[model samples]
Target: MKGISYARYGGPEVLEYGELPDPKVGPDAVLVKVRAAAVNPVDWKCREGHLDGILDAVFPVVPGWDVSGVVVQPGVSVTEFTAGDEVIGYVREDFLSRGTFAEYVAAPVRTLARKPRNLSFEEAAGLPLVGLTAYQVLVKALQVKRGETVLVHAAAGGVGSVAVQLARHFGARVIGTASEGNHDFVRGLGCEPVEYGDGLAERVRGLAPEGVDAVFDTVGGEALKISADLLAPEGRLASIADGDVVGYGGRYYWVRPDAEDLLRLTELAEEGVVSVHLSQTFPLERAADAHRLNQEGRTRGKIVVTVEWEVEPAG
Candidate 1:
């Protein structure tokens, strides 16, 4: 099957597109025919060996974690889904290889969820990793509650956009930081938009006056440190990108695949409580371009790679 891969850890220039061996399905996995895949910053980070200490790399690695596709074959032990089911997944494995960038992937049932009926394959493909990242940080790590005031860094970004919506859904008054160009876009997600960089703290203070109850940092580094300083006396903080949060009495979180969390996001999508804003779509062969675009750090929402395939009706 045709797919994109890199034999060694490096930049987007190292990616190669061609035929590769099909992934084998394990007894606990289902083989999916890829319809669409979404690019996350982690895809490039992994490609460049940034996660070398945390995730084992198998050379000629297929790089991607988000996918929306049709189930073509279910393993003997799989019962949650059958052939012909349309699903979305954050298909990360214990090791790096056999990823969603390919024409097919053997996804464990734990990572699979029924696609939201309201979303197309492209939109559904964009949800898993980003949606789950925001959901986990807001719902699990920070435990944001009703009527509280929350601040989200990089609010117009893939994760931050979803974070803004989720915080609003939880009844929190949300303040999101983005560039002036995306202020309206952030407001559309139900957040009070503030421009990021220098004096970010002062701007947030002007919006909240009393300090925010919780802070969710997606940009890390300076943003994370600034978020820590904007917190109220008992404020909580969590960051997906910065480990520095731990030193500042905040928690650092890494997104994990939870079928239940994915289901919650699916419900939000179906109910029109959350929406994906796609910045670009590329063919599978042009994955390098997708990576380049994401690395620029200017895209809002998601970048999807669509796969062309004939869908046969299940008899």
Candidate 2:
């Protein structure tokens, strides 16, 4: 099957497109034919060895985690889905080898969910990781309540955008940090948008005077450093970007794949409670370019890489 892989950890130059062997399915897994895959910053981070201490990489690694595809076959022990079932998955494991960037992936049942019928494969491809991150952090880590004020950093971004919408769905008033240009875009997602950088805390304070009830930090470093100041007493804080958040009385979160949580996202999507915005799309072979654009750090939403299948001639 044709796909992308890298034999060594380096820059995007290391990614190559070619034929790789098909994956072997386990009893608790299903084989999904590639339709589309979403590119997350973590994809490039893993490619460059930034995640090496946590996830061991098998060289010539196929690198992608989020996929929207169809089941060609189910594993011997599986009954949750069968051939022709449309599904999406955060197809990650403890290490990197087989991944969703390929023509097919063997996804464990624990990572699979039925795709939202209201979403296209490209949009559905962008959901699993970002949706899971937002849902997990908002519902579990921060416990944001209705009528509370919440602030989200990088509000127009993949995880941030979803977080803003999900928080609004829970009846919280949201404030999101973006740029002057994205303020309109962020507002469209149902939040008051504040430009990030110098005076970020002041801008957030302007919106909520007493301080927000929760701060969702997607931009770390200096942003995480000041997040504590933006919070009201007993206000919650969580950061997916910085581990130092733990030092500031916040939870440093890493998103985990859960079928139940993903299903909730699917339901929200179907009900029009949340949406995945596709900022760009690239053919599978040009995945390296996708990484380059995402690394530029100005994307408003998710970037996706698509696998186009040839149409069979009718006889």
Candidate 3:
């Protein structure tokens, strides 16, 4: 099998692409022949040792969590899916040795969900992490309701883009912050677009004279601070990027692998209620280049790395 791996903590330069042994399927796992994998900031962050204290990293680590693929083998205990089932997974294991940026991944059954029929492999690949992040923040963490006004930081981004649409589906009025250039794109996703940076708080005030009902902060740091300040008296706040949010009466969340939550996202995609926006894609060999693009931090939507393989017909 071909995949990307790094022997040590570093930047994209540490990534090497070549043949490696295929992953092993466990009693509760399914081996997926990856059709596509999505790159998130955490991929590089983990590679550079930023997540070392939190996640156990086995050097020569394959790095990625989001995958849309076909199940080629199922574990003895797995009955939720079978060989040839098309699935999507946020395949985060307890350790970082084996990952989705490969031709195959042994994904635990708890992390696998049927891929949305309306999405191509490339699109489905982008949804697991970001879609789950958005869904968790809005529906689980914030509990946003109909008729509420919510503010989403970095609204045109991977998680934020999906969050914007989900907020609308929940019947919340959304105000999303993006650059002036992506304002229209944000608007098309059902958000009242507001330009990010310096005067963000004042601009948000202009949109909602009263504070917003909730704030979903994807871009952290000062944006998290701003989100804390802009919330209504009873407003909820959650940040996926900033742990500092805990100091501001807000919760910090890390996306967890849950097949049921992912299935909800699949339902939303099937209903045309939310869509994964693919901004760029690379062949599996150019994963280092994919990391470079994601590190630039200017992408409007998800960046995916695609794999091509022959799927044996279902018997």
Candidate 4:
């Protein structure tokens, strides 16, 4: 199978496109013919050795997590899906040994979910990691209730775009920070768009007047440091982008793939309660280009790598 791999941690230039042996599935796993895979900051972060301490990689590591595909084969013990089923999932971090930047990848049946019927392969590919992160933060970590107000930083980025929409779906009046160009876009997600940088607090205050009930900070820098002041008394704050979140009195959520959550997101997508917006896509061989665009941090939504031959026939 053809895939992209890096022998060592470095820049995008280090990635190479080549052939590798096909993956072998375990009794509880399924072999996915990857149709499209999404890129996250973590992909490049691992590429550049930023996650060296937390995640050790073997040489020639395949780097991708979010995937949407068709099941080409199912493990002996897998009962949830068959060879032609459409699925989406976050391949385990431990399995970076064989990542989604390949023609095929194997995942535990427990990590995979039926892809949303309403989404295309490219759009479904954009949902797993970012969608799960947003769902966990709002529904699990912060327990945001209806009629409250929440603020999301970096609202135009991959995770932020989904987070803003999900928060609003849960009945929170959402305020999101983005550049002027994405103001109308964020507003379309039912959020009040706040221009980020320089007096963000004042701008938010001018819009809400009563302050926000929670803060979801995807741009963790000085913004994370100042986020506490924007919250109402005892309000929660969750940062999915790992940074120094020590004093914020809220949890730092590192995303993990939960089949249950992915299933729920699928239901939401099918119901038109939430949507996945794919900003761009590259062929599997051009994994370097996908990483380069994501690392630039200007993407309005998810960037995906499409493995064209793996796409399933339309239902």
TM-scores, all models, native as reference = 0.98, 0.99, 0.98, 0.96
Model 1 is weakest, by summed lDDT over 10 consecutive residues, at 304-313
Q: Taking the tens digit of each residue's C-alpha lDDT, what string does model 4 give over 238-299?
A: 88765566566778888887889999999999999888877888998889999999999989
Please identify which of the two predictions, 2 or 3, would achieve the higher lDDT against the true structure. 2
**How accurate locally is residue 73 in candidate 3, as Cα lDDT from 0 to 100?**
97
RMSD of 1: 1.3
What local lDDT does model 1 show for residue 137?
Answer: 93
Record all residue pairs in model 1 with backbone atoms less than 3 Å apart, i.e. clashing: none
lDDT of 3 at 62: 94
Q: Per-residue CA lDDT of candidate 3, range 167-278, in tens?
A: 9999999999999999999999999999877898999999998999999988889988888889989999999988999999999999899899999999999999999899
Judge candidate 2 at residue 63 and give its lDDT: 95
Task: In angstroms, give how far residue 103 of model 3 lies from its true place.
Answer: 0.7
Better of 2 and 4 by lDDT: 2
> Which pairs clash (backbone N, Cα, C closer than 3 Å) in model 2?
none
lDDT score, candidate 3: 0.93
Which segments of candidate 2 are over 4 A away from where they belong? 313-315
Question: Across residues 249-309, which tens digit of lDDT does each residue of candidate 2 receive?
Answer: 9999999999999999999999999999999999999999999999999998999999999
Deviation (Å) of 191 in candidate 2: 0.7
Task: Give the clash count for model 2.
Answer: 0
Tell me how far the alpha carbon of residue 73 in candidate 3 is from the true structure, in angstroms, after superposition.
0.7
Worst 10 residues of 4 by lDDT: 241-250
24 Cα displacement, candidate 2 (Å): 0.5
